[model samples]
Target: MATLKVLGAGPVKRGITQIAAEFAKASGHQVNVEFTGAPTVRERVFAGEVVDVAVVPAATMDEFAAAGCIAPATRAKLGHARMGLAMRKGAVAPDLSSTEAFRRAVEKADAVVANLANSGNYVAKLVGDLGFAADKVQRQPDAVKVMEQVASSPQQLLGAGQLPEIRELIDKGVAVELAGPLPDALQSVTAYDAAVAAASANAAAAAEFTAWLATPAARTAMAATGID
Candidate 1:
């Protein structure tokens, strides 16, 4: 049996963790995953961090392959997740039925909380394009922290991040609930990809895990956590 270390983006944490457990059970391999923002994943890989597998945004994975951090041929698409909103549990959910409604919701929010990840960056730009002031947005380090701020705040806040991440925190009793995904016209879906690291000592086991991520069972697990 071999142990495979996986470094993944925060948005895919729940789905990847579920798939990792299933793979570990069937293959008798110990799979450990560290979840953080995509930028942090790239930074770690570039800094020479030794990892067996890496899962991040598809574009970032391509960058890794080009930089010789991960094997290009081993790359596989995981899935995509849509950006969504969350609010403290029991709070009146915002009207995200349409783009205009979304604009009104943001305009009425006491504060807009978002992570400093890809999803957050997109939402920040969308809000700006809608003519909202940048100062109204409070950016956190990651999704977990973004939810933490929303859950702890007494003021009415709109938390923005990947739906899977928002759902994960809500399921963990984080005092938050999904406010619904951004209105269709204003939605953003981020695609994710996984690959075995070029410097991995457990490349074979890592490859097995990455390949299994596209299997039927893995897709089921991913969908259960909001990953499309």
Candidate 2:
């Protein structure tokens, strides 16, 4: 067994990292996981930084693989992400029982931070479907950054651009409850996947890590990280 490394966008990183830890400990492998933006991973890989694996939105990897930077056959779909809403700690959860309340909360907030990645894109489309003006939304590239924004302000409201991040904020007392169900008009149900870098010298170890991540034991550990 060899050390397994992973680099990906923020939302799934936490839960997946936890799951990876358990898999490594039980499988007798060392694990080093790095969380980053979608574009950054490709940049680093092209720059020759060594990495065993990369996990990113399924859609984003097609171009890289097609260009021969990533091993296409080594890719495996992980799962999907759902969007939700949040507020800072101690702020009462908003009543998102209806579209009216949800929209009103967004409009009334001091600032509303949305993601620009998978979760954020879904949220942006959601805002449009809900009939909110473009000026009403503030877009950020990462969900963790959004969480940081809302959590830093007790009065600020935050929207979960993705399921994993929304669950994480609530669990960590960063925000209040998530908003209503992420409708398709605004939801992308982001497809996540693990792919080996073409330059990876540790393909066998990387493949093993991905396999363990898909196992029941991995799911069990993920549950503790607000993965559902």
Best by TM-score: 1
126-217: candidate 2 lDDT, tens digit per residue? 66777777756777667767777777755566556666777776777664566555444434566677787777778887777777777776
TM-score of each: 0.97, 0.81
Give lDDT for model 2: 0.70
Residues forming the 10-long window of minimal summed lDDT in candidate 2: 179-188
> Each candidate: what lDDT?
0.89, 0.70
- For model 1, how does the per-residue alpha-carbon lDDT over 110-206 read when each residue is reduced to its tens digit? 8899888778889888999999999888999999899989999999998999888888888888999889989999989889999999999999999
Task: Tell me, by lDDT, which candidate is best.
Answer: 1
Clashes found in each candidate (C-alpha, N, C closer than 3 A):
0, 3
Off by over 4 Å in 1: none
Residue pair clashes in candidate 1: none
